[model samples]
Target: MLSAILLFGWDFAMRTYFPEDETPANMASREDAPSARADGAIDVGNGSAGIDAPQVVDVDTALASADRIIIDAPEILGSINPVGGRVDDIDLKTHRQTVEEDSGPIRLMSPAGTPGQHFAQFGWVGEGVALPGADTPWQVIAGDQLAQETPVTLGWDNGQGLSFALRFAIDEHYMLTVSQAVRNTGTGSVALRPYAFINRTSANASKSTWNVHSGPIAASGEGVNFDWDYDEVLEEGPVELGNGTDWVGFTDIYWLSALITQEGQGASGAFRSTGGETYRADLIYDPINVGAGQTVTRTTRLFAGAKESAVLSEYANQGVENFNLAIDWGWFRLIAWPMWQVLIFLFGLLGNFGLAIIGLTLIIRLLLFPIAQKQFHSMAQMRAVQPKMKALQERYKEDKPQLQQEMAKLYKEEKVNPLAGCLPIFIQIPIFFALYKVLLLAIEMRHEPFFGWLRDLSAPDPATILNLFGLLPFDPPGFLAIGVLAVLLGFTMWLQFKLNPAAMDPMQQQIFMIMPWVLMFVMAPFAAGLLLYWISNNVLTLAQQKYLYMRNPQLRMQMEKDREEKLRAAEREKADKAQE
Candidate 1:
């Protein structure tokens, strides 16, 4: 019955309270029918071609082969490939590849032709106007290097009447503002549409988990966000978002790459998984008509790098519609956002994330103190009536319905709820999932350290009892990676169970005894921060139970009676052995 209650409560919280957002109406309507060209090719609207088959090359060769313009900023370091005029080679200076301080910076984008080639490409595509393709070699017109203070401009001119120029400006952080302009230096008026696309040769290394979104996500200003898996994008062909303030990009566990546009701009966006391990998130603005001797320019923003909540929120606050939605806060944003804020506050107060988690658990316990007190008082009443309940059970052994009616009547008279014990677990279910989402999606928690042997709180505990906590030379299997924290979690759970009122049925008693150890094994693979939270929660609960039990005379009396009965049984067994 307890297991059923727990499972049902968890399911209810996940399905009802934290439901996945339905695919945006625009996306849903276009899912079955995508636009196609007259030639029977999948028209990825905006003049974007089908996903190109990637040519694999070594990273060193790809970097060395490209004639590049360097990009140097405080937060980002990369270069632009002139061959395609793609901002492709980027490394996030603020983030490392691993937890070690000496670890290399995280490589965010690699140039094309590499094994893990990924890049952002911006260009003009139009009919009868010979625009630059992937093979066009752009000439650096203005700045030699791209920086926060200095913007770089790359220009290319077709033998026809049109000349295109791209001016790139980057902030200190991750956002890049690219402005595309065209000059009709010929006799005839020319029409061209500006388009920006992020292309990747392979999916991210981090596997998409149920809790964290790690693939294509789009948000139309209609207050709805569409999240899709890479496989879904591949199987469903292409996802198109019609005119609105929308952003389309790929989100990994910690990093994000998105194309941003202005509000009410009639731009079209599409996400397509090209064959041979390639995926593209492309956006194209409406065509601009430039008369002879006239110039037209359009601007858009590109966001690439770590998905810092504050940075995303700042962008959202600065008129980027729903930019904060980039961080997958899930459906329970109301609860999860405040919870995350409090956690961040606690982390600021306390330097260590482990301590912050413990602080958060204490705050939750204090907040729910009144409800827990009532629950414990009702439990005490139930414990006091256990003897009467057993007598009633014996009296109505054959009449199950009558026994249930009598028990209900007894509970009413005693002012006790039989299911009141489930209140805490029910209250905790949402919090548990919220914290899980925060730990899984928050970049601040990535590679954040706790005390000894706990290097990365967001990652599973590395030390294992089976390997003597790394003292042994050989490595232990994943299931056997039970660390000290996991053991403490089980111990605290067991302690809380011991403090609770004894179950009436032997089977329930047995289950209660084994449930903690079972959960410890089950949670062995979870993040260390999550295990720390659970352990702290269990300990606090055990403490609360002990304090409540000590203050309640009825509970104290029941515990004393059970203790005396156990002692008497032990004495009787010894006496019987002596007589034998």
Candidate 2:
């Protein structure tokens, strides 16, 4: 862990400390665009930074006819990629950040940053009328525009060994497009292969960044991970723990790549992420003759939209690494996606939002019900045979060997399985972890509604103002609602502990009792969505156990008989084997 931290620290330091060249004198300041300040700075109205739509550039002008153009401007808004901020409430408050002109690479104002900050890119609009060309079959025309309905054409330079130009544009709906024109200007033909890269950095420059916190725990044999390659494939490495830079990467041609290769010359490709972010890079790298000054041009499109597998599949099929649902961090795919999908599916099936949560809880209970029943049945059998076992213990109290022998005989006769209970919970451990991750990362629950007072299921219940006595502790009247939810969580947890006493051993009980307080401290700042899931799950489990207990008082007795039958069958099988 220490070593991982050090490595991550070293990587961050290099990125943060690496000196960037000054902005070119000829280049127009981003603030020069309409609604920008004359001095090239963002105007904060009334001490608040209002979100301003990004400046759209003429595609033809930005990707003007040029030879070997290197667009190294640190902060070119539309030129950078797109991102969705915070998905997990226990983690960080998600929002976009303010743009600083000094930021070398265009910064994505995601969670932990300011709010409403965005860069337009490719978008999806279900099977309806899209933003004009959205549904239109895209070609290498790679035309760009500064505003709605205006089109601009871009060209490449002649005579240069390698000539490439990039154009930035936003369609009517503000989706981002970065079209490139790459050409091998030399006499000999060569492939102008394209690759995309991504990295993480702090937006605030004044403050020294100690570390960037990310993650819940990791599974065994897996290391702390992050996307290194723009491809978004999660590869395992050494366990990286602590506050520092962690990176993961994958090649584009791998699974989920949307590249359409044909006759060694591919044109117009799109890359889609399963996390709902997509980037399209078109290739026009056709062979050219130097003497005649011929060149090939390529253009690309990027979409920062939904992570629905179907959506991604659509883009991937178009020959770009689009629709990849792989979790860029940890075992999110293996754990998070399935869990959230289950919750979402349940919520949709149930008409009432709050009842949907109840339904989800019931489903989980039913799935685990068989295992829990088996465990409880075994425990009952063990307790039933205790009287006989106690007699043997007393009779052989002086003869230790005889007591042990008698105990074994009693176990065989009564047919009690001591490990039945332990096995069930153990089997559910992976599922528990998967659910935990889903609650942390699923965006489907974001701003979702759960009915009455809980207007937004994705957020915590807002405090309701009532003059309930100063007894609520916080002098503020609104705090009364917060206190109520906290109490409800506590009561439910306590009741669960009381009813399922066997579920807690000495250590487990201590941990359970202590964890709520710790959770309170942690959840106070978390999104209310997570708290709701936990509360609902607990309540549902409590109700299910109570129902089972009431419905079948002799359930344990039946289990004991079943155990005896199994034991007798095993003995008969052993005898048959010996005779053979």
Candidate 3:
């Protein structure tokens, strides 16, 4: 019931606060059709907006069919498709599809006709002016190849006295600057609105996790940030933001492509999913009127590459307008961000992410040492009063209230809080989740190798015991994929439980004994780095327990006495059963 209420409340909050525009089906009849008006102003309705529907074809066919210009930046390789002059194909030269050095580069964008058709396009929507369309084959007049030092310029003329020139400049990294210059050479003035869009025809192929966002995300210069899933965009139509310096784009687990502009330079943009596989994130500027023989230019930037933390921070620092918010830090940003920074620092020192995780765990344990000591002392006190507690339980077995009253009185008299042992666990929960977020979201952990049998700390341990660590022929499924680290984690957990004070109830004792193994299976699918941290924590806790037990001699004596009595009782019962 509580879960249902929380879910309902969350739904209500989303609908009320983050309300989206009407669906495309509902708006189709109300809005103008997606085409140019008689005055040459493009009627870019919410859905199916700005341009004609793309034809379905393979990526190779699309690239082969277009007259393409090569893009040869230091970190990126792609082409400028003359068919609409779109920055269609892009591959990150630094990142590979696989860990192998010989693997292909990571492809970020593809031609419009591909299976995963995705591309970034820039053009103009104008009134009584001729603008480039999807079929317009732009003429490359400047450079043959786009590079860091050399820029590429594409030109087109409407023959009615309006000429358009697009100049593209790229940096050594992944930022692209597109400057659009419109010259009015006609007898009359023409009005044009510069626009940029990122279009994706298919959903992301990467596995989507609930915590990791993989869809449309936007941020404004005014500090507003919003994100939506693909289905939400489809159901809610378009998300309209008022004019401000803003950027909107799509983000997968690792890559991002956003269109950015300065403050108050353009009209507020919209992130729209056209009620199908087609999705577009676009920014349209206010109309610019240019008189005859006058030229107007507008510039926008594009960020398309891996979402690295330092790189994103640099861009954000360089006035990119909340660009660092692109990486989904979730609700735990306060904890997760610092944790990530610490991990990066430790990794730089240790040269291994696994070692860095171990280092982080050690630091956290040290910080929580005082609280843990209190919990351990309280547990020892509980152990010392175990006999008295059992006596009270037997005396008040039939009276539940009386038993609770007696327990409370006994706790008060002994100065022991029964809930003290839970404090450490409560504290560890947030740290555990924060570290999980760091491992899952930070790109630094991707493809990082640990010690033997742990090639990827971000992924689950691959070597399964069921396959005898790859010696056996048959492979095991996910449930049966318990590896060496998982087994060690279970063993350490069992040791930690055994070393601590035993529970008073038989059912509780049984549960404590069974939980470690159950969690071994449950945590088998978690990252190996997480399992390593858990194991390290358990070991530290076990050591702490030993020290506490040594210091509390009375508690140790009581536990030993209880153990001896249980053993004697068992032997006596055995002898009696044999005689009978």
* lDDT (Cα, tens digit) per residue for candidate 2, span 1-580: 3433554465567667985544321111111111224663221111011212232233334223332112121111232211111110010112122122332331332211122112222211111111111112222234332333433333333334554444545443212344444555456544333322111111121121112112111111133222232222222322222221111122111111111222233322222221111111222222233232455443444333323343444544654332333333244356555555667677678754456656666677788888877776776676567668768877999999988878888888888776775876686566555554554444444445665556555455554234252334454422123434454666677776555533214578677666554444334333455566567767876776677666556654444555676699899999999999
Candidate 1: minimum summed lDDT over ten consecutive residues — where? Answer: 24-33
* Per-candidate total of colliding backbone pairs: 0, 37, 1
Instruction: Name the regions of candidate 2 deviating beyond 4 angstroms.
Output: 1-152, 156-179, 182-201, 204-293, 299-310, 317-323, 326-336, 350-355, 389-409, 452-486, 501-527, 551-580
Q: Clashing residue pairs, candidate 3?
A: 39-128
Give the top-scoring candidate (TM-score): 1
Ranking by TM-score: 1, 3, 2
Question: Candidate 1, which segments miss by more than 4 Å at Cα?
Answer: 1-36, 39-55, 224-226, 566-580
Query: What RMSD does each model have against the real structure?
Result: 6.8, 16.8, 6.5
- How close is every model to the real structure, measured as TM-score? 0.89, 0.51, 0.88
lDDT of each: 0.79, 0.39, 0.79
Of 1 and 3, the candidate ahead on TM-score is: 1
Residues 316-405, model 3: lDDT tens digits: 898887888787788888999999999999999999989999899889988998998888788778887877998998999999999999
